[model samples]
Target: MVDFIVGKYNYWIYIVLMMIGFYAMIGKKNLIKKIIGMNIFQTAIILFYVSIGCKKGATLPILGHAHGHAGQAIQTSAYINPLPHVLMLTAIVVMVATLGVALAIGIMIYLKYNTLEEDEILKAVK
Candidate 1:
């Protein structure tokens, strides 16, 4: 169990970060704080995905090494998987777009009520 945890420290870190973000998103009363928490959660998820593409002693998945001579075969295990990293890049763009929309909504809410608090907004709405 200790070996598993030690070997997968990135997962542990990501989990901790995700939990913190989850807590902030649910526990905070302010709309802006919730948005910040969402950003944190997005970041943790991206890092976790990128980490999944990494290997301990692997190189990037560059096609055909320029310096390698003929008859020398490249081992697949020596190269890190690039798919997760590519997917995470797309995820980051989506996260940014959503965050922008959320912030815009938050701004509108604040402009209307002069407060970013969820409870205050609810009371004002009522």
Candidate 2:
């Protein structure tokens, strides 16, 4: 049990981050807080994916020159998988775009409603 917990500490950290974000989104009343929570959640997911793509003592996926020229057997397990990292790069771009749009929308809401609180906005709307 100790080994399992110690070895997977990153996962535990990610889970805690996710829960914090989830609680902020669900329990907060302010729109800005909710948007921040969503960003935190996305960041946690990206971190989780990036962490899972790593391996113990693994190098990059790039093939060394000697292996290709000398006809040496390429050991697949010696390299870390690059797909998750690549996907997370794309996700980071998307996350930034989403954050910008969300902030813009929040600004618009604040301008129109004169407040950033969801309950206050609802009351004004009603």
TM-score of each: 0.88, 0.87
Q: Worst ten-residue run, lDDT, model 1?
A: 63-72
For model 1, state the Cα shift of residue 44 in Å: 1.3
Candidate 2 per-residue lDDT over residues 66-89, each given as its tens digit: 655577667778889899999999
Clashing pairs in 2: none
Q: What is the C-alpha local distance difference test score of each model?
A: 0.90, 0.91
- For model 1 the TM-score comes to 0.88
Supply the TM-score for candidate 2. 0.87
Off by over 4 Å in 1: 63-72
Clash count per candidate: 0, 0
Model 2 superposed RMSD (Cα): 2.2
Residue 66 C-alpha lDDT in model 1: 59
